[model samples]
Target chain A: MVSVVPSLWGYAIAGYVMTAGAIGLYVVALHARARRARDRAAAIAGRRRTSTPP
Target chain B: MVSSLERVAGRITAPRGERILGWATLVAMAASAVMSLVVSPPDAQQGNAARLLYIHVPSAWLAYLSFAVVFVASIAYLATRRTRWDRLAAASAEVGVLFTALAIALGSLWGKPVWGTWWTWDPRITTTTILLLIYVGYLAVRRLSDSPARRARWAAVVGVVGFLDVPVSYLSVTWWRGLHQGTTIRLLGESTIAPIMQVALMTGVFAFTLLFLYLVTVRLRLGRLEDRAVAEALSPRLGQSAEALLEQEASARG
Candidate 1:
């Protein structure tokens, strides 16, 4: 008679997937935030340059 | 001394340097995943369920590292009253929170299979949850004041005080009888983990540390840019000259 060991691959896979997904999402969010900040800085700088007399 | 140190930091944190660091982080992460999933064999007892240890351990370790950084930076900010230190503390705290949450989630996933439950009131788990709440509160405190200096002061106080939970969470397993296992990679004595497993775990840790550094660098840059934008917006109303504002911004960026 063969003794069956329960497969835990599902839990392992879920853990790995969740870890990767969360990190990837954070990377995307950081990029979005940096882009927004860069754009805002540029917009403000442009306004200042335009308003300042040469 | 500070100016010189800031100059060095400014050079190292430049875009080109960041790109190199980013590529190195990606490579390290790939190697870590390969080692963790393929190279290392599964545990005799937990079998495949043990695989979660790679990411889970690193996430927890990185969370500890992040909070430690926040603690030191907060102290420096309070002592020197530097915005640079405050920004560093803020960035570290945010990343720490991410890793703390990741650790908890991954721990839950691991527990469900091995311990036959998704959640428990184990000392380590309970203390870790409290640790997470403390940092979350610290972040919330940052938004309480409109004045940057005031916000930093309040956040610094919380950052310093809240770090006391880190040691408590770390030693909770030994201090109390709990479902959580004791430390695996003992520094003073032989590690309980197999050699190959240790290698895989260390690789995961190194990769996560690199990722942490990259994230903090990017976040710091974002914080500087956001501050600059705010300064620019407020400059006209406050009668601050553009040259003076630019000088202040450059100093802060360092």
Candidate 2:
């Protein structure tokens, strides 16, 4: 009979989960950073755009 | 004529060279995983534990390679005052830090099966832990400094000086009769392991290296973009100053 105990597969599952989680975190970080930088740039350029009003 | 050396050197340092690095890295990582997992036969003695070598060795090599770049690039920046070199050093350090952490984790995991332990204060491991700490501090220094010139200057000096620990970390095994094995890549040439495994590991190392290059380039570009934003924001003041100087010259001539 095949054992369905979690201990047997736990490490493998954990390893896979960690890999997925780390990659996901990295992706999220990249996107968040890019978005923040974009917003910051937009704000900077927006102020410059409005203040000069040429 | 573009000498081969010059071409190779240019490719390594060029900003756009990262594109090549990105493709190479992906290819290497895929090939290595396949080679190590499917192609290479498991060791009779060590069995599955040997499998860990694929990720472990490459990450370790990356640690050395990253610090080496920091050492070399930092010196070049200090000598030339070019922000570009400093940026490369910074990028390499960040990538190196990632791999170093991976190596430590993989090492501990592998050790449990082979050495019956999860952690050890072995000299090599301790040295590596310290090396990781030093680089982390290097990154902190970069974050703490706000002025571009001062940041580069301080970071470059730290990168160059901090490199002294790299050799010590590498030699720790050789220096002490430690449980951790000495650097393994040197054995690549004469290793008894099958050629397929060799291909896998070499592919992985190259891939990781390329990946590092791509990442560094992107990060540096981001830094450059920020600088450009600041400069463009202040361009009006620069223009006004230049116009005032021109007006003063015109009045003096009259």
Candidate 3:
């Protein structure tokens, strides 16, 4: 059997890398944004409690 | 009152089984990568460059699938006027755009080596790009309104109409003369590719589908939380308690 062109390997590798990288980054961003929103909500609730007279 | 808040909070939290789905997606994707790169043999004509099909076809499938979800969910939201359907539609659109962008980029990458050009005005490429822009507009529609019902209504319209482009994109290669190849794989008929390549391609499709499901689930949960946060932020200005604010928002959404 004839061997595949060596240069084609780079293209294949790059395609996979880009696909995986995009997905991984998106997942990380989602988690980070969720954490930030949760913290913001907590802070807002805290301020509401502290500003109110006990 | 406490129960109502708890219920809202629970709805915003990650859906059950999301964690397991996430891990399964990761494993499946890894296997798919291995199968595509290591297991599958090179084509006689395209050589190893054909391996790009594993990622390219799957990303395209996902982009198409995501938009179909958005289309169906959008119709349901318009009919029922439910926030959940709206959220699902929005979440699906977001995921669909992500995959669409990936598909375009991967196609460009493949084009550079095979077609000897980084870009082209081929019917398939043009139509797919149009599909991407339409959903990008859908996301913009979501940001255009503060009122939940108005936002859902407007976005649902875009989501439904924007879906017309999907069929156009799928058929462009057939409908018009193009540099892109026509459909090689058929659901009702046999595929023209080798068995090993077909297996690798199928694995890629399964893996990406799982990933799409997991991401949409996370996005839906996050969307609800963000909506709640915005409602809560506006509560003080409206002179309403959090519970009352949520109730009003829920009713308004209905």
Candidate 4:
């Protein structure tokens, strides 16, 4: 069997996986930080409300 | 404001002598690249193809070394729970990944002519590829999680476990049938390569390592800046001018 098609496919897929993997990882990292920031903000607000004297 | 910023650049972190050394290394690395790529003898077997060995081998060495730093730093972060260690560990990982990619690609270039194939599952090549994947996953997991400490912990575990793969990759050809050439082990006077070759190879190694260090330092600085920017952007703090703007922007979000 010719190695041509499979080799090309391997290179193609590797290229995609490399890019998608990097971008997907970066986007996920950003969203995670955003979610964390939001959660942190909410927690601080909650703490403020509870701490405020009547 | 722009003039003020230009003045601020004069007061940046690095001391004068250290800055000079850094610049010296840049000059030295260029000189060594010439020595290795131009002055060094072509291998009787691979000719100029072997010239790539200078770049490929040192890069491979530094990648392993850098990741080893990440692994240790990650473990330290996990044990101490320090965010600085987390930053350093993350920085090393990104740099290690980039260098490792370079090594693998350069190796393939050498492999095409020497081995008659670009890759083989022979122990070294396979294990090295595995090492690359492990780091890729380390970076992936890091990217997937938001908490700096959490990402550091998970990546630490992966990095430590990843260490097992490195030596195996190093010894793979020695241990089994492989596409990689075994080290040219020799005894007594035969132990040394020709002086020119040794000079070329050693200079190449040092140059590449310097280049790698420069790259990693820059990457680490960028990562720290990015981390600081993101942290400041999200918080309501206003200690700095940037933070003040960030707070105002956050209010607009409200």
Every candidate's lDDT: 0.88, 0.69, 0.84, 0.64
Decreasing DockQ order of the candidates: 1, 3, 2, 4
Interface RMSD per candidate (angstroms): 1.1, 5.0, 1.6, 9.4
Give per-residue CA lDDT, model 1, range A1-54, as digits (tens).
642556687888898999889989998898799899889977987888888887
Candidate 3, which segments miss by more than 4 Å at Cα?
A1-6, A52-54, B1-16, B236-254
What is the TM-score of candidate 3?
A: 0.88
- Computed on C-alpha atoms, the DockQ of candidate 2 is 0.20
Per-residue lDDT value at A15 in model 3: 87
Compute the lDDT of residue B111 as modeled in candidate 2: 76
On residues B96-188, what C-alpha lDDT tens digit does candidate 4 reach at each position? 787788678767766776677887677777788888898888889889766554566677888788888888887787789866777643434
| Candidate 2 chain B lDDT trough over 10 residues, lowest sum | B241-250
The residue-level lDDT of candidate 1 at A43 comes to 95
> Per-candidate DockQ versus the true complex?
0.74, 0.20, 0.62, 0.04
Candidate 4 stretches greater than 4 Å from native:
A1-54, B1-22, B185-192, B237-254
Local distance difference test, candidate 3: 0.84
Candidate 2 Cα lDDT to native:
0.69
Query: Best DockQ goes to which candidate?
Result: 1
The residue pairs that clash in candidate 2, if any, are: none
What local lDDT does model 2 show for residue B172? 88
* Per-residue alpha-carbon lDDT of candidate 3 for residues A3-53, written as tens digits (9 for 90 to 100): 555548788888888988999899999888777777777677677677777
Model 1 regions lying over 4 Å from their true place: A1-4, B1-8, B237-254
Interface RMSD of 1: 1.1
On lDDT, the leading prediction is 1
Sort all candidates by lDDT, best to worst: 1, 3, 2, 4
Q: Please, what are the lDDT tens digits per residue for candidate 1 over residues B1-254? A: 86897787687579987788889999999999999889998777787789899999999999999999999999988787777888889999999999999999999999988899999999999999999999999999999987677788899999999999999999999999999999999989999999999999999999999999898888888888777777877786545653356445444643
